[model samples]
Target: MADSSSNSLFIKPIYIAFVIAFAFLISSPIGSYAFTAQNVIDSPLLTKKIGTNRTIKVDINGNGEFKSIQAAVDSVPEGNSQWMIIHVRKGIYREKVHIPSSKPYIFLRGNGKGRTSIVWSQSSSDNVESATFKVEAQHFIAFGISFKNEAPTGVAYTSQNQSVAAFVAADKAAFYHCGFYSTHNTLFDYKGRHYYDSCYIQGSIDFIFGRGKSVFHNCEMFVIDDKRLTIRGSITAQNRKSANENSGFVFIKGKVYGVGSTYLGRAKGAHSRVVFAKTYLSITVVPAGWTNWSYVGSTENLYHAEYDCRGPGSESKSRAPWAKQLTKEEVAPLMDVSFIDGTDWLPAWL
Candidate 1:
């Protein structure tokens, strides 16, 4: 009896070991939480490749690197960067900054978008480039930060040029819970594929402009006007010049509110394409949903359309003759996951 008991004890341990191994193998692929925990345990010493030790803490009162945003960006190493984190404290940074192409993997985290603002005032016709904050870095992410261009109200009327607050010209970039504030051309997607989720974008004319493939999901778009002018004066000016270019703009589950006029949109590019799926529009949107850039030509080749939009402004009967209301069957192909999906190139915080 003693020999049998000892044998049972040995077999029990083996069985337990087998069970543990099986659990790990099965959970690793199916459970994200378990997989992440295992990865951290297995590679505790691993670190980010770029900006591994580069951390810039910017507080209005705290003693750290330069106080201005431009100064801090200039201080980071020039080329071949892995990752860098810039922690901005609660303050309004009034400066125009640029993230050059040389530096990649820049993660800017602010205290909060409501508290931390990077603001500048530059009209597109003021000899300043249309884009206030131009980012040329790949895999760039901005969280809890606000980009604002405080151009004068009448400045846009005098100058028909588009003024962009934040212009993104990078690939695999993402903006989470950020605020883009401007009178016109708030956010410009100049190039590459990008994503903006849970963000607040405000503007008057073509607030969200650009020629890139992007996805804006669960975002709030506010058209602030003292008097009703137009809803979406200019939404997209996609520049899909090359046949190989796969570029378009997607707005999913977004809310549009008008502060004044009721004109919804205008297309600026020859082959510009924009989609509004599962969106809510306010009464400020005109009955004719879309307008042509000059009202003399058809935007048929531009691929402008809407699907499953709700609210008072979503009526299809009064929509522009040139505007194509897409059916679920016609729009299903454009809803592919890979349309806006790229390499997991976004930062961890985003």
Candidate 2:
């Protein structure tokens, strides 16, 4: 009995120390750059390779090739095939920037998300027209920049009052270490095969919407309640009309939290697909997990689901009946970069 008591005393301190360390880890909030060096995907800042040496500078102080971001993009030829770097200097550019479909392979680089920002204020019935920064070109890449639409909080659930921070409507587009800020419909990921790495997206309702087949890796989603609407808001409203369309939003290893309760996603189509895998959900996420509120279509076709998610809001006992509990084999493809065919064209990925 004396020997057993001595062994217990020796192990107690070690167990207590491990518990304290684990508590610290769970309490720590994700920083501006969520992932460590190993987890980052194709980070240009770390890779130091922008595909080509053809560099253009955009400085607001009239010191570079152009004063506006649009001007620098305009300088690129319509049939641009090779990678060209447009280094935007540290400043808040207050204008609407567009990358037309004709101009491709343009890499928009910034000092950092905190230092470089593109801001505009416009609310319209059209989501694309109200965007502060719109990208319509394929093979586009942006890093360390902030895109924002400063339109005041509009009445929720209204199309005419939609404010979009960024509109991505082209294929093979990627953003890294960037920030998107708006009140409603923040990121219109309309149609594309896109990748977002370590980005911060903030909005209230239907913030990340559209039919884009995209992968969000280590991205942080901050939700703000729309006081105008009595009903709870949703983080995503994916519009995958059919399973054959190959359109969905897959979020991996990110954190979603903020003020007011909201669903992980709401059904926007009969086959609307949205998956959250290995993500952290705070109390901000409602117990229902997903909703089909305005969508009167059959919930049987909806693919709203969660896999390996944690936190207070991830409890599945009260999850919606339609919400799927996927097995490892079922979720393997969605959790991989191959889901978007990133290994073929992307410079690097996990």
Candidate 3:
């Protein structure tokens, strides 16, 4: 030891630096980002095995069991009770795909959202007709795929035609690491008890709609302005018409951000229920937070609420008077995975 005092001074500075760093690590936004990254990295739905090992491969090239996705789906027996995996290869499938109600327990797996896509260009007065991907089958699961409606963005309020990317109309459906992209009416979440994990949904108007008792976990909503619309677009249009419906859309630990302004949700029915819990709302969200245009009924039963949310847009001062900042007790039942009975039907590894 050259000098005991000199050694003491050197160690002291290093110790103090480490202590400061630890404090910063615990207090900074890095902690939140780390938690989000952990969810993405440790998703239980990414497992190779969904339920059974029966797999059908669909490749754009002539290498797999089928050349087209629909062809592979047709190959599956009519009333499929066993879990079968339809693995789509890394390519853009420019076609419409639908899973009928008769075929249940099917898992549609793709290489990745960035690599695999189902693309269609259609716009019609009928919501079901414009959809690119439709799932009317119960007990269905999908992973790492993108469903996109490439229809030309139409004039906002002038056109009767609507473009829907995906129509999920059956119960017990789950999606992991998926994407839905469209200009308007992107995800017509018609009706179901659904769970979405680490998914991205982008749209302009009424992006996520319908009366689904669903839980969106770690999902992202990207809103773009419909320049033609005189009114701002809304992220959701949940149409729970009555208190006894047991239907609502609950978004947990997600983020909403994008170019133009939008509301968290709109009251499409007398009892339109929606909750945003522990979510990050960016400045893209309007200060009104929620809207009730065209809904002429009393607001007493509307369950539009936010809980423990953060970010500039989460500020409550200017939010609509009808919108609620729920107490912890009020939000407890909605936060758990049991809200959609996910634990019972979700993957065993999850």
All models, RMSD in angstroms: 10.1, 7.0, 4.1
Sort by TM-score, top down from the best: 3, 2, 1
TM-score (C-alpha) between model 3 and the true structure: 0.89
Ranking by lDDT: 2, 3, 1
What tens-digit string does per-residue lDDT give for candidate 3 at 114-226? 98899999988888999999999998988889999988777654444589999999899988889999988999989989998889999888899999999998899999878
* Model 3, residue 337: C-alpha shift (Å): 1.4
Show where candidate 2 strays beyond 4 Å. Answer: 1-50, 157-160
Model 3 error, position 237 (Å): 0.2
- Which candidate do you rate higher for lDDT, 2 or 3? 2
**Model 2: per-residue Cα lDDT over 231-275, one tens digit each:** 678999999998799999999998999998899999998899999
TM-score of each: 0.78, 0.88, 0.89
Better of 1 and 3 by TM-score: 3
How high a TM-score does candidate 1 get? 0.78
lDDT of each: 0.72, 0.89, 0.88
